[model samples]
Target: MDTTLQDPLVGRLLDGRYRVDARVAVGGMATVYRAVDTRLDRVLALKVMHPDLATDAAFVERFMREAKSVARLAHPNVVGVFDQGADGAYVYLAMEYVAGCTLRDVLRERGALPPRAAFDVLEPVLAALGAAHRAGFVHRDMKPENVLIGDDGRVKVADFGLVRAVGSATDTTGAVLGTVSYLAPEQIEHGTADTRADVYACGVVLYEMLTGAKPHSGDTPAQVLYRHLNTDVPAPSAVVPGLPAELDELVACATARDPEARPYDAVALLALAREARAALSEEQLDAVPPQARAQVRSGAEDRTSVIPRVLPLPVEHTSRLPAPPDPGPAPGRGPVTVHRRTAFLVVAAVLLSLGLGTGVWYINSGQFTRVPAVLGQTEAQATQRLADAGLDVGTTERAYSDVYERGTVMAVDPAPGERIRGNGTVTLTLSRGPRIVKVPNLKGTPLEEAKKALAAEGLAPGVITYAFSRSVAQGAVIGSDPEPGTERSPDSAVALQVSRGAPIEVPDLTGESVPDATATLQEAGLKVVVAAERIHSPEDAGTVAAQSLAEGSRAAKGDTITLTVSKGPRMVAVPDVVGMKTDEARGELEAAGFRVKVEKTFPFLGDTVTGQSVEGGTNAPEGSAVTITIKGL
Candidate 1:
């Protein structure tokens, strides 16, 4: 059944931009959907917070903050965040959609993977987490389900909704945020998460990939949490025999109960993992334990042949028996007598044929010899090793490799120790050293295009710092470290400096307080410099009245903005404009900075000032209003 057809969100447009196409997966806090950005005409994954969780303002804010943080990461191995917004009760984050299965799916279908396959997935996952850790973000929840293996064989870390800055306080009052099976001891106990917490989770994932089961399992989540806090993760070899000791050490170092004992961060753990891989021999690396479902399937013939036979089949007799009629003929002649010697010979002959057939089958197909380990060895060395094992070299191939040296054996057919006929041949694949490429000149290229260029050259985009440059266009690359034309190893990160464009328009700050004006200017990428001298003005004291640069004028980033603060209004004496014609009094008072009013008696009208609110010589604040009273006489 197509369950996605029943989802209400399916076929609905979210925020009028993302057209939700299909429900991808549901989690405790959100439901992820495969959606297309109608406006941008691109596909992306939309993670909508569950309506219940969206109601919590704190949770929603944290979720959106996660979107912003992950968006800043910009790592190739990390899923990118495109946009974040809400449509009524649905708060969604549009993310880069990876069209492939999760690591969880691989484990479920294949059980324990071969060491090579396991490392192939783990390395990229670690790289992604390492980038996050270096950028001061921690993926609090790391699990097999969050590791996305794309159809193009790219591994990306997804679902960073629980990501938080390193050393940030976690919610200790309520339920923990991560899956219990992959939780670190510190996370389970105090609800504190750091880079080490993610390291621990990655170790657990690695263990699962090696053993086809989680390192710790319990009947309930609480039980699992308890175990995480009290018990240490067992070695993978404990469950899957023949696993290399180096892998055991790597898992142990990462899954240590004490966060202090584990690697400080994902990058440190990644280095350790690489070191372990380098130290392992091809035999150790390719060893397939009995627990591996793939190995079991590959050895199916051996298992099937080992089944014991319950009973032997009877041999067919060509000659028809003389039957009971021979009994009557026995009296007449010896012809009715059974030929016991002939019957015994016939039975022996049939048994001999069966024995010969069994011998031939064992020699041709059942008998086997183990393939010799020859990885990392030179072609000549590998050939000699195979010859020692009574095997011949069949085909020699060459391929580029970053890990293996040139002319060294990178891999072998049938792996290192799989069983094969004694006369079988092994194919050797030799390495051609690391792939190197010259960094292209990305100056003046758009930031996005520059990133793509780096990726095309097998390089990764590193920290991006922005600066104001008149020569370089806005949102374009200013330059890069290591310069252009420099050769670098594949997947090396190159630091980039992007242009923030021409100076920004400085907003007018008149009538705003010093702090408010300073903040407003800072937001526009301008620095504030308050003038020490105070000036009398109509504006309130401490308010900005004048600026060094005119309003609506452009100023470069970090440009100083001088602001003149206002003092209280100046005091001025009121002018007496009474007992004179209204026009004369108004003109005379206005000349002296005072207003005039007319007054008249009851039965007659007169254009003359009568009374004033303030005394003639009394001082009043400048720009303050003065009232004049008029009477009819």
Candidate 2:
């Protein structure tokens, strides 16, 4: 279904300027919508605060103040916020629109990545954060979902100014669950965040990239937060064995449970990252880990990553690099003829110097050989090439590949140009074409559990839709697209329909007592909360004045309905204008917050008022009507 069409803002002009087109994403505090600034004729992402939140005048004021501060922070990595405004009940921030997925999406699709690919993403992210940290801003909430990767391969940090709108921890389970996964121990234990906190999150991100999984897992946000407060992040190599020790050290240094033990800031951490990367050999950088899942992507796969997402670098190590010059001959040119007598003399001279000849053979030929480049070659062609280099073919094997064609040599031992023993055999692994997996049945599974199921089968969780279902429990998956047992390539997205339980019609609770309203809502399987502030309304004092949801609107069971109580109509003091001219008295009454009705005794010529309906110096409701009697002339 086109959910955007159902949104009241879609197709409606906001602030008589911005035209909201489509809903892009939803967060706990706001919903991001693709919009256009009609005045400037530019597209932007509109992050509109939830209506319930916008109701708080104090909160909106702080939100705008923080947004203005963030807008002053000009950096390429951070998402640009242009303007902040409110239209009626809607408060929004117009930000630069980036059309792409997030790091969360990439991780969901491809679990572990080769070290080179992981660094390509991590370095740029750290650089962006370094800018933020230096600017005296801390993104208290740093998660993969906030890392935007554009189609043009530019990485940007999002939701910078919005985090301060709420504290580090929230009451919502969904919000806390995603946030707690990346929080540092200090952030979890004390709810304090500084630049080092961001470094901790980056370490967790690196670990996830290296192992294709989070360092910690639990059934609830409390469990995850508890682990963060107590547990130290493990080395990536612990999961993906044989991972470089340098990478392990890097993760350990950044993810140290003690804040003082970690890097001071993202800039410091970025320097450490560079050092770690520099220490890695080409082979270590490009070696795909056992946990790295093959992706069904091709031709600039990093188009989805906003960061510098170049493909995994080819493995090229400088082993046996000290050999003497052996530029034997140039290829594709005519060879000059050599005299037979000259060649015979040279061979005889070498034979006469037996000790020197043996040393020369060992240095140049017998001791070492370079593995010839044969990636993406036919199996037969690779075998011939190996033979030409005086190397033996040890084993022939094939694995499914998304990039290479079947029967082509996709990988080789010792990689290209790496040193191999002169008598060693090179093992060639051929491509078996693309792989496919059947989607598992996930009906009746909880949402979080379903995501795990998809990950287990090397598939990624896709867009989720919520619907009201009677039979299925709330928060449980009703069904999935492509159905169970449907065949799909690895990392293919699977959309799910989750149950919202049965829908309930929200009843009007305005004018009711607080206890009565709460009892009524609780009986209807809905949660109720009274607003923190009371607003002045025509309704009686201490009575329900408004609700978050309109009367008769359909809401899912357990949906929270907020009630706004009234402090009653405002009272204004009446002015002492008795015995004055009728026109003057009428004007004074109206000015003092009263509707005026003048009555002239005869012929309507009595200009002077002897008395007024409201006694002078009396208080009345601000908008109440007041009648005046004029004495007859």
Count of clashing residue pairs in every prediction: 6, 4
The reply for model 1, stretches above 4 Å from the true place, is 161-178, 295-633
**Model 1 lowest lDDT segment of ten:** 306-315
TM-score of each: 0.45, 0.50
Model 2's TM-score against the true structure: 0.50
Per-candidate Cα lDDT values, in order, are 0.76, 0.81
Candidate 2 structure quality by residue, lDDT tens digits, 204-301: 98999889888988878878878888888988888998998999999999999999999999999999999999998888888777776555443222
Where is model 2 more than 4 Å wrong at Cα? 1-3, 167-175, 297-633
Q: What's model 1's TM-score?
A: 0.45
Model 2: per-residue Cα lDDT at residue 77: 79
lDDT of 2 at 64: 95
lDDT of 1 by residue, 352-448 (tens): 7789868745643456666665666789998998899889999999987765679987667765645577778888899888788888999999999
